[model samples]
Target: MSPHPQEALSTPRAAGLAGILFGLLLGTAIVLVRLAVPEHPASAGAWLTDSSRRSAVQAALDLVPFAGISFLWFLAAVRDRMGEREDRFFATVFIGSGLVFVAVLLCAAAAAGGMLATAGGANQQLWGFGHSFAYTLLTEYSMRMAAVFAFCTSTIARRLRVLPRSLVWFGWLVGLALIGGAGNVSWLELAFPVWALVVGGYVLGAGSGRTASG
Candidate 1:
């Protein structure tokens, strides 16, 4: 009945690719930040003075905007794939959490950028504030929102039978790790991107299979 068979098949493919891109970009940025910045900003501002660390932080900040953009596309593509099957209640949480995560991510990037710009300045207090603010936004706020988004997406995928049981369970574990310990554990943030990578790979493979069958 549909006129555009290719168009009908495109949404899942788009979602899969976008999710993969987002996960890679975001994971790289997070790794860069984790390597360059200290867990406690107040401990020492030595990274600001270290050229290599400063360069790594700068590179991380540069990747964040692109990662955020990719995430938006991934969110849109996933929502489009869900179509009429999406539950309004879970959908609201999904959309809200994703948007908030992007917002928090960007804000953290801006804070980090400001901190870098003021690295050579006389205002040590401002630098400390910015450094603390950026990490707080990233680890505390952004990750929590990411947890919510993951949970909602997994629930929707399970309901629609779009994702496998293994992925759904993995997603729940990712969500739990993020919400429960991401701020306390520096490495836990990687779970979100890793989960995204797995989900994206599966979705892309499934889409390819459908295209072949069609």
Candidate 2:
């Protein structure tokens, strides 16, 4: 007899491949952004004003493609494993947070643009406010991004039951990491790409077709 059509889509092997690819792409982009940052001047405001600053911003923005693609792949994987009908909540968790992610990035771009327009190589409240607003929005979505993934992962794990309990708890840790980005430790933002990568491996390597709840 043939395997169930759904079975093929939900197989551990397929999810594993997708997750690895997602991790590789996301991790690569994070590395690219981190490397690009050092090339930029220390002041966010100063960097925003210079032509060189624009280059750095462009380079950073380029990673959006990788991030966006990883997010899409994750969504597809979710649909395959969980079924579209039953997993609408997790679906929203992933997609809604993604929409917010894009919004925050756009806000960041706008904030930088505002700074570029106003800075006279000195203090400008307009530009500073814009950048601050952008960062605030970025922090908000960044936190939400971590949380949404945490919930989505748990929901999937609960259904699939392939992952060990300890690994599942790590997903919650990823969510907490985002909270630090909101405070003085903004550099901690680097953690997510790695977290996503590991989670990608876990989801693919460890998951059963039907999570425990399912």
Candidate 3:
């Protein structure tokens, strides 16, 4: 058997990887659309021509795979604690996050539609700004802040028995720091890439091992 007992323990890294991939591709889509949009280098509508919009849509589709893979990964990790303490709190965070994600997605789709409808209009450039702003807000709400809360809670529940309380408490504090953007531009966002890297490394280290359902 593989060394790790819980799939949830392996989840953070997986979830992190999914978030990174989504960020990379979605980030690229935004950049490309911005470049192509008319009347603005910064506007997403510029690059989002019919063809580019299709590309952006595809990029958006990519998020499903990214999130799905991580979701399963985290699911495995959290399986052990499914009904334990703090599990319900994480559920609350997930629910809030889903709401935020849906709202942001609606905003993005609307903004994309506006850009397409007003391609030739001069005053409609606001659509691009709307997309970017909504993107930022929703992403922060869904992935960054919510993620920190979820991660800290999961780790605390995991470490409550053996790990030092100081370590567990520090993790919770770091998670809070990540959510509040304590040091700079969202420590959560910054930590995501690192978190992904760690997961990828761990999965790699567990070379030839398989993820089995218990």
Candidate 4:
């Protein structure tokens, strides 16, 4: 079934807003988490025990859910705008990878939250495990999923000409960086948010003028 005319008309604007919110929230959360947890741990216990570090992690975790929600809205709005032009195969991959990314991100936050919950107990081993698990989820699994999402979205956008050629190329670069560098390089995952920001800003600037080509 097709969306109502009014809803269809509003989707691009909503998507732009959602994407901007998602990018900002996700980028801030990543920065906070990086500040809280060192890429190379000097001492595993310190991250969990330090008051400021713990606070930063908690703040990051708090922002993640909102980011995830905004991302979902962004996805929905984009799909709605695509309407009859969307390719089902790519759409499925795009949506699936996006949802997986969010789920893994939430799990990562939960792992960090668990560390905080157990902080007073002085369980260094558990804290270490949770910290490692959270980082793995964020860098390895979640980011890889994000890479897939980026690739699929870029491909679809390019085919539909909904996004500019340069932006589509940039999206491919961001996806490759996320896939290849996220797990190895500290702060490399920031590429995802950077890409999102560019895309979002473009969408907002383009406004209702841009529509998916049939």
- What's each prediction's TM-score? 0.96, 0.66, 0.48, 0.91
Runs off by more than 4 Å, candidate 2 = 1-54, 84-95, 106-123, 179-184, 203-214
The prediction achieving the highest TM-score against the true structure is: 1
Number of the top lDDT candidate: 1
| Local distance difference test, each candidate | 0.89, 0.57, 0.46, 0.85
> 33, model 1: CA deviation in Å?
0.7
* Order of candidate numbers by lDDT, starting with the best: 1, 4, 2, 3
Relative to the unseen true structure, what is the Cα RMSD of model 2?
A: 5.7
Quality of model 2 by C-alpha lDDT: 0.57
> What's every prediction's RMSD, in angstroms?
1.3, 5.7, 6.9, 3.1
Model 3 C-alpha lDDT per residue in residues 43-80, reported as the tens digit of each score: 44435546755556555544544443454354344333
Alpha-carbon error at 191 in model 3, in Å? 3.2
Give residue 8's error in model 1 in angstroms. 1.2
Task: For candidate 4, write residues 102-174 as lDDT tens digits.
Answer: 8999898888788778767846566667768888999999999999999999999999999999999999998
Stretches off by above 4 angstroms in model 1 are: 1-3
Candidate 4: misplaced stretches above 4 Å? Answer: 1-6, 208-214
